[model samples]
Target: MAMPPNSVVPTTEHTTTTTTTSSKPMEVPVKPHHDARSPSFLRLGLYPITLKFEDVVYKVKIEGKGTCCGGEVSMKEKTILNGVTGKVSPGELLAMLGPSGSGKTTLLTALGGRLKGKLSGKITYNSRPFCGSMKRRTGFVTQDDVLYAHLTVTETLLFTAMLRLPNSISQDEKVEHVEQVIAELGLTRCKNSMIGGPLFRGISGGEKKRVSIGQEMLINPSLLLLDEPTSGLDSTTAQRILTTIKRLASGGRTVVTTIHQPSSRLYHMFDKLVLLSEGSPIYYGPASTALEYFSSVGYGTSITVNPADLLLDLANGIAPDVMQEHEQGETTEKDQKLVRQKLHTAYETNISTRLKADLCGLDVSNHINQAKEVATRNHVSSEQWCTSWCHQFHVLLLRGVRERRFEPFNRLRIFQVISVAILGGLLWWHTPTSHIEDRVAMIFFFSVFWGFYPLYNAVFTFPQERRMLIKERSSGMYRLSSYFLARTIGDLPLELALPTAFTFILYWMGGLKADPATFVLSLLVVLYNVLVAQSLGLAIGAILMDVKQATTLASVTTLVFLIAGGYYVKQIPPFIVWLKYLSYSYYCYKLLLGVQYNENDLYECSKGVHCHVVDFPAVKSVGLTNLTVDLLIMAMMLVGYRLVAYMALQKVQ
Candidate 1:
């Protein structure tokens, strides 16, 4: 469980922490979370930041339509966001409007520093690159809500508050902050309800969306990027959410959101807008004047039409005449493509040149400030992880337990474990020790079943949490060491519970050994084997990151172990018989036998059994002299497998 000293160290230049301040909270139905009533974030003296990007182009190499002579795939460079540009000063809300494939989320991901691959652009916060400080200072909410279904809204927000807020803040303050956020987001009504998934109902969509935003709000972030925050909600709900977002932007924070389509009122609420079409900027300017700007450029607009619907229509290359074509009859894709081309040409000819000019002028100040800002930002970001190694371990461990306590307690799983134990005990009930072969079979079965049961269950652990890990890690919530250690430690007691119960019941009913020392040693051996099995599961799962693939590999791996375990085929080939030394099942079975009989005090001898029972055909490998070696090897595998998993997970991004 111990990690290297540097493993938990933050990934930036260590420096003093800074707190971001915001403007006074706006009046609303519920009380605001800022001003004097805000969370203790004010005491932190954090700085507000402006978001600026220029020439932000993102492209990917995708498979082309045609293949090579030998049927090899052809490649083509596909541009997703073609030289998109904008800037959002603090206290302004900028909205990105585009069709489904127009690169809105991709741009948002880039702003959050979560996008991967070829991105050529100038993206900065406070004239600095996306360093650790801005990472902690920024909050990015994805289009879909990613949350624990079982966690109540309050618990969800409280947990985030505890982990995300600086450790310097007290427990009471964190709770109070959670309460204030609950009121601010109008989530007070559903505070106690669960954030349910597709399988169950909990809070409404708007409430879930609010909880996602609240997670970021607890930090009072300087730069907040949300991808489609009001998507899939009614007009009233969407407006309320937008109103809250406006208030947040009013608090001297730079806010950028992607809107699919907004009502006229919601559209007017935005301070700035970036309109996109087919990965190209068709227009970028003030939200209020977008139509005016477009009208001056010669596209038609009516005052009675909702601006959002009209812009969407224009972005899709459907003009008033094209709508007429739709109303009267069918219009061709060729017509839409022609309109889209005209829009892009106008943007490039008129808007693109001006934006580039402004950007060229801005670059001088940026380069002058870049060096100092980087040093300062890195120093601040390095300090933003907030808690000591032990502190992180403590909180993560508790959260892990609370989050997973119900997993092993599921009624069907519980019944399965108990029923198997009872079934096994009945099958081998009170067998006489003289039946040496039968007793050995029982011990072997115990070793194999306990080892196999946990491996499959453990294989799914990392895959399920992969998205959560990436989200939290990108925010610098906790070091990977803390998460890995906390997860392994928390799972220990629960994973061991069923196996312990199974062993206690089976050992007595089967009457293999009555001595307390012998039973205790037997239980330790089984648990140790289980640990090794689960570690292997974790390693494979982390390496593959796909449940089905990991399970297939695990199944094949354990099958090899089972065959070489000296039971199914006692005579293994010399080439692979060495695998027995590697099989946890083999070592466990041998250890089980070794624990039953003492070296000096033998006397279980019979004509059919070896006088030194440890030397019995089923138990003896190299020698009982190597028992400690066996334990050491299994112990190495236990820790070694987990270390492999932790290392592999670090590459998962």
Candidate 2:
């Protein structure tokens, strides 16, 4: 195992004891660096990771319920990866090439420790078990770019650095690392630009992909695994991304990426290639040597033809008939299978066997002895958290605020709030005391308007960010509680603003209570009710990851609450009285009515020479006499809904 010309071997010292299935012990040298008190990036020396997988097979079970007489359930097993074997040494860029449904992504996920299927094989790092600590040192970039659309590239990377880098690393050092990565990935031009999505245009697709890569690179991973890094990018952009990956590999990190039908020039960038078809390896060797092996197996191509296209064609079992002209007889399915078997056997005999031998038999007693001189550094424990919980909450809160403020349709939301307020105010303009029905109608409209508006708006919150949340949470960037709390706190001000405007317009225009204390209390109650509504929406969104489903559920629940609201049903049925207690709208309506009219207030029943006077009890009739109890109940609903939403988020990842 010789280091590549571009590889940088660390100057520090550490010892790793490799324990195999056998009782014997083997020593391996792992370079160490400055103590934990030192900066993380400074301590990240040439920690080259050599990833090797032998006879790896991944299978998933699909269960179906039986429709027979016994009505039993049956399980079927599907093999995603069949006996896949390969080696990616330090400083080498290995590309896994395969067609759609060919298991390229699956294999990459398996290697990155993100796969959930049943797997059987030996995956080793530095000829030792790839434990949790080593897993933390690796980075995985999924096919989709999971990032904040509102945050600028610099802000995105800085927040990631704050959350993913260890606490021992100072904020200034983390910022430095983010800047270095930004420059390294050629993202300086877009450093201050937002990574926008469909609603808002910002950075280009290529730059967004670069930011995704930078996020994973922030940890200075020893092993970087990417799934389809160039899946949706143009040729030039794809080339640039691969070039960055090559540079990273040249720095002694093991880089493994899955590529789909890359250009010829892009194909040449890979040092090693693993071609797969139907979950089985068709070719696994040097990129330059692949054509030679294919040619020997009757799948050869001319120099002018794109080797990548030809390889993909063969891997897809669609190689042109002309390529098989060398064979004497007509081509058949049996012959194609035979050719594939021959290629597989050739790789097994000439490459896999030799690589395994080198890995098992090669001795570096001198390196181990040198590492033994210095105290064997303890295995860096799996990071419990990259930053403190408070830091995560603060960063997430800022990101949430930015996202909400810059949302493309946010102006429409504000307009909606204003429109609803104005329309309700115009419809019930200055209701008189003589018209008790109009006052009741105004209060009912206020309750229903605030309840439904906030509910629908907040329903999209969790579902929209579900992908980003899952990705970050799985990476151990922050605690779920921090994110939940930050989002709640971040959106509170905006949530209250709209309701406050609505309250201001309706309370005055509808001629509700004009007393200063009563007016302020009324506005507070409405705002709190809006919070409860939004919290319910958040819970629904988190429980159901799909926006349409969450919205439907929210609509149904809101309708139920509206119906049970006190105004809608003045005389409640004994059996369904408990349902009203569960409705936040009911409490809000009762509180608003209580705040507007007092027990001693008089109502004129008849208007004539002789007018009949009657006293109407607003609060006691609806069983909402105590304002404090109503406020307490509304607060409880707010917390209860938010708590449920948080619990739902915990189950998402």
Candidate 3:
């Protein structure tokens, strides 16, 4: 049906319209909803979906505030969203307005199908249960911008487009989509700017928010859900972000956002308003008619004020100036309770009854579900990723490298490694033929430093990225296996680059051996040790998703390994000697020694005297031997630790 000029579009399903000329909202005539034609409100290539829910009651278990008797733990159920019920239609912007602790964020999460607790409700998309297919079609931009701070704006959107866009679309088309989104969000100027974090500065707060929205828009989603996208921004930026959202809604998208204390102008942009008070609905209807409805119920704004401000005051159970006539100043607890009760009762009697009626008549989704077309349109959410496994790996590989490439090779790190390498070379430079202990000390330092350095560097990887991982994984952007493999493999070149450079300079300067094969073998052991140590760090980080704890464990583990590697003490206590086998550091030390010296090689005993050092107690204790076992052990560790890490990541939930 064509709408008249200067008319406000219907706010929600079968609701009334308020035109500029009318002071009161005009009721929309009810049409026979039983017709088989789908009621999706837009045609954005994909059919627009009407998101509906009824009687949504979400509760969570919380620890009791009271002291537990007999040292027993106490638990209680807290209602996060108490019987929250509302629906959003395609091409309509529904802003969930409420004060703090009113369950706005909780309600938004539930709507996005990301809520993870006990929820009792009838939430259906196109009258179908939430599934994998809907997750793909739905674009959920979290309240906090969850983006890679290191990636430029264009790169961030491009990576998302590659992973989220269907494989049937050509690469060129995906790039075009990214550009279009950037342009649409007014981000073309800052396309190349980084989405910086605490460590760096890049885009403005508003631009960052826009990038978050653009990430979702790239996919051309039918439904867009945002949680406080205007949060922590100045009024001007907030208004701009809301304006972008309104335009997106106008272009046939279902938009639902939780807003806190929006200005009157911003409040007017919302097509519908769901005012919540302590998890219960106080009002639900067209935004323009909210004050009208409240006025009929004996509590309404007396003076000209932002509708959002009035709604928030009502949500907090503090009546607007209208209540000031009864009592001066602040409302007491009793007064608040009374106000809340009255408003909730009014909503139940006047608004909820009508909403339920409209929902019944507008449940075209359920009606459509029985048709064969439903199955053709919807699928289980298990078929999660839009791209194939190889394609996901490729896209993730690019993204991971783009994010982490500079981390290991930044100027400070480069200077640190080079300085250490040069100092080690000069300190042990061309050790005299008799200084066996000095050469041995340098080799031991190599093992300790490589083992310790790389372990700490990699230990914080998983913990730092935990939030980003959870956000992306929850959306089913890519499989955990692909992400794990991509992150690990992408870091390989960067991880080994400095180690190779350090070893190259240190090896020639130390002048332990002149043979080409010996030098190569020694370098190989150092690089291999670097990799094994990094694997240990990855395992620890993944298993214990806390950075401080992981760092502490890595420190203790490395110290223990260094002590047990047979260099610190010539003799070991038999009982605790098993720790040596558990330490990759011990294996690596033994291998480096094996590369430089063997049983037959002799060092000067003293003053032109020569003896087989391998036969002596000190050299024998170091356990220099033919190359097989130590190398094999470290190699096994390189694989085994990463396997454990992968398994640990699988249980993150």
Best by TM-score: 1
What would the per-residue lDDT of candidate 1 be over residues 441-478, giving only the tens digit for each residue? Answer: 99899889988888988898899898888888887888
Query: The CA-based lDDT of model 1 is what?
Result: 0.79
* Order by TM-score, highest first: 1, 3, 2
TM-score for candidate 3: 0.87
Cand. 2 TM to true fold: 0.85
lDDT head-to-head 2 vs 3, winner: 3
Question: Any residue pairs clashing in model 3, and if so which?
Answer: 132-380, 132-381
Backbone clashes under 3 angstroms, per model: 3, 0, 2
State the lDDT at 411 in candidate 3: 69
RMSD of each: 8.5, 9.4, 9.2
Give a tens-digit lDDT track for model 2, residues 299-374.
6756567888888878755555545552444666776676567666776776777766765765544333432331
For model 3, how does the per-residue alpha-carbon lDDT over 1-653 read when each residue is reduced to its tens digit? 11221122223223222312111111212232221122221111444677897989999998876655677667999988888777877678998989898999988888889888799989988777988878877888888898887777878888887888777677765666565566667776667667778776778899999998888877667679999999999999999999888877876667899998898879989899999999999988889899998888877665888878778888888877646643566557888889999999988999888988888888464334432343354322246666899999998998887776445346677799999999988888888757888888888888888998989988988888898888888777898999999988887886799889998998889877888999899888999999999999999999999999999999899889988877887678899878888988788888888888877888888788898867656457767764687778888999999999999998775
lDDT of 1 at 352: 85
10 residues in a row with least lDDT, candidate 3: 21-30
